[model samples]
Target: MAATAIPSYNPSPRVEPLVQYRPLHPTFGAEATADFATITPDLVDEIKRGLAKYGVLVFRKTGLDDARHVEMSHLFGDLDDVAPFVSGLGQKNRLSSDYLFDVGNVNPDGSVMQPGTMRDLLLKCNYHFHADSAFNPRRAGISLLLAHELPPAHLGGETEFADTRSAYEDLSPDRKEEIKDWVVLNSQLQCRRNANTDKDGILDPLLDTDEFDPMKHRFGKHRLIQLHDPSGRTNLYIAAHAHHVEGMPIEEGQRKLKELLDHAGQPQYTFKVQWKDPGDLVVWDNTCVLHRSVPGGYAGKYKRDLRRTTVHDMGPQAWGLNGVGATWRSGLD
Candidate 1:
């Protein structure tokens, strides 16, 4: 007698649901609270669109490891190899890949840098408000900062961000017209020197040095204002890296830039994000915002480590930076 063969039955594949996005700020930025494992291709597209609309997107409770972080970064676009910037930070001070930009006060040996140390002094430069990779010809479209470890909220390690789009919108028509045809010259080292150099009859360098040269720094050119394509909005491009304005006197341009910066940083136009938990990822649009690290309780006493990845724009069009033939700027940060 022949026995009937039994058939194997397979259940239907589970569908990935859309994630929820709650606005964090009035003008720009949103918080995405979703399970990382459930993120699908459709959700990734939604996130890209959200980034375009909000200018900043944050993922809470991601708990992403190194591999997951890299995988998540690929959702926006191709990754930029920034290994040159990541190297020399010590073995544990950096990740295995050059793509990760380590931003922290902790040392490679799992220890915090002593206060007033050279590394600690270098971090002081971050106190100045500026966008990541603004000195690069192909500026970063999206910059991700994942909190690996954070000190107590009372310790004061907070990151502040200002909305450039809102600032541009509040500008007077005449002022907008004046800057419409203008361009800014950006220099990273020059900005760093400016912040560290002793001025106003006071010594401020983290380390003393007589050989201060601004001419030897790398520089780039960017529009005085960035016209975003998706939202059809204009955002001021002025940052700490913008040393001077093109086609204008150095002093006058600098004065105007200073004035613009002052106006843009109004309390109403800015918000502070407190990094209280690990695995919280903040993705910001560098083209439309200026961010800086607030002073922590103590550099060495507390463990505050945050890893970053600066993703280059999808080309000149992504940033509305003029034409497709734009060249990459030779700048270091």
Candidate 2:
């Protein structure tokens, strides 16, 4: 009896978590506590799960270098290079890796970008709520943004995100049905125009330029309402990049788009993330959310060096209406 009892020995189970998440908002953003510098397969899987549930994940003080940033981004999906887009602007990528995009107001010489400059004006479009690479043939799925250097505290430069999935759920049944089958044409030029609409004479010089002509560029045609596969919820895909409805008059489509955007961007469905440390990282699913940069007094005074790596959407609707061989073009291409 004793020998038989001794034979059934069991050791205590040991369990360790790869990562943990703290909800930042009631519905959307989360703060992930983990060592992102040393990424593992299990860590990546957990990160993906967090993105699906929260739509945005903020990691503080990850201390990931440019190489590590690109490496970790690859675990999400194929990385999107900014070369094609920046080349058309007649600017060279200051970052060492093509996968790492410069999202801050810093010049190649490590100087602050003065206001009213071409780069500064172009970056103003980021103030509007929009999804990354929405105008590209294959839209962006995940974006990993790291703060390499930040401006002084309380000077602003915070990033804001809108929960489109939750916004869609808030819409009335009739409203949802009205846009259920609608398609929109998304263009980079349209995004710029929308951002500068109120600024008198700001876009005049660039309007007649071939590179800024909406008619000369190809547009990304995508459904206004789409099912976000990861979260298994429908989302409003409208953005500032959306030019007009597929079959409606330009004026009518613009009005409808503005209405939808205004409703979706209400304060109840938005969250703002402040950059506290230089190593702070924020990963967001562009497919289910829209993000914008907040303007602060730090512009032209301090350098905010933010770098981002974008992953191309690999889902069924990744290419939208653009078929295979539809490469990325900034009008010049």
Candidate 3:
């Protein structure tokens, strides 16, 4: 019989530097090194920097409640008041505040929507690719979705993200030259109409064209190629909300939009993220990526609840002479 020697502990040991991010995808997507509770202002600044570099980040096992979710979202930037769109949607049971955007399959009464119904069909509209608040002039920079409730793995409620930045980079020189002068018109009315329209007829009968109003919904016209303010990188900003290229025929513009979307949707530029746990949080750059919810079978059978918070870009010119966040620095160097 041989006796094993026990190792003695040293008075002091070398401490390894903490890893901040782990890469999830080559083009865009990373996982945080620590828990959400340990995320301080400095770490948040680093996360912001990482977000500026990578298009998406996934934080796993963050057991955050509604109030904490809102608190953490504010560290990135000022929260957008999404009350208008969320107010009439549903129950406020899990919502920490009215401003939190509910991105879920659960009904207002904490029940799942039945399959093939109008509400179910409307939820299917999210299957199309789009950036959050793209039609608005005050575009969302980053969007964070926290998984409050998750469905069974077999049910499949994954989210797909396309890196528009990489997609733009992958374009051929000729294609780039052709689209350089193109301008895209993004409108909520156009987006809703496009979603409801199908091969034979409208999928959702409740969709009304008469209710379209510019005053009620946001709309904007932007160049096809968008430059990232922080990184100076060019990204394609086309989305479902984009109606057409200015001055081009409607049919031609739509064809071009579909072509670009198909190109961007390629497997190389797209990442389909599945929720492995209940507390998973996905943070992505809305400015450089288009995302969509995967419509799983029977929303009523599988319950998937999620909360989203958007952070607007805080560029100096963004808070110009009369902006809300800051006052003018007209003569500053």
Best lDDT among the predictions, by candidate number: 2
Candidate 1: count of backbone clashes, pairs at least 3 residues apart or interchain: 1
Please list the residue runs of candidate 2 whose C-alpha ends up more than 4 Å from where it truly belongs after superposition: 1-10, 199-202
Rank candidates by TM-score, best first: 2, 1, 3
**TM-score for each candidate, following the candidate numbering:** 0.85, 0.94, 0.83
Residue 28, model 2: lDDT of 95
Clashes of each: 1, 0, 0
Model 1 compared with the native: what TM-score?
Answer: 0.85
Q: Write the per-residue lDDT of candidate 2 for residues 1-333, one digit (tens) a residue.
A: 545555666888877677788998889999999976578878988999999999999999998999888988898888899777667666788898989889899998889999887787678889999999888888899999999999997899999999999999999999987889998998988877666656564654755477777767888888889999998999899888888899999889989998998887999999899999988999999999999999999999998999999999989999998886588664554
> For model 1, how does the per-residue alpha-carbon lDDT over 1-333 read when each residue is reduced to its tens digit?
898889888989987646578888888877776677754677667766777788777787688877777777777776666554444333343465667777788776778878766666566668878877667656677888899888888988888888889999999999999888888877665566666666573435543343323345445677877777656788887788777888889889888988998888888788888776899988887778888888866566888888887777774534334344455443332
Better of 1 and 2 by TM-score: 2
User: Could you give candidate 3's per-residue lDDT for residues 54-111 as a string of tens digits?
Assistant: 7888878888777877888899897776555544444244465865777787776777
lDDT score at residue 240, model 2, on the 0-100 scale: 85
**What 10-residue stretch in candidate 3 is worst by lDDT?**
324-333
Report the lDDT of model 1 for residue 333.
28
Candidate 1, pairs of clashing residues? 137-329
Alpha carbon lDDT of each predicted model: 0.73, 0.88, 0.73
Cα lDDT, model 2, residue 238? 80
**Cα deviation of 253, candidate 1, in Å:** 1.6
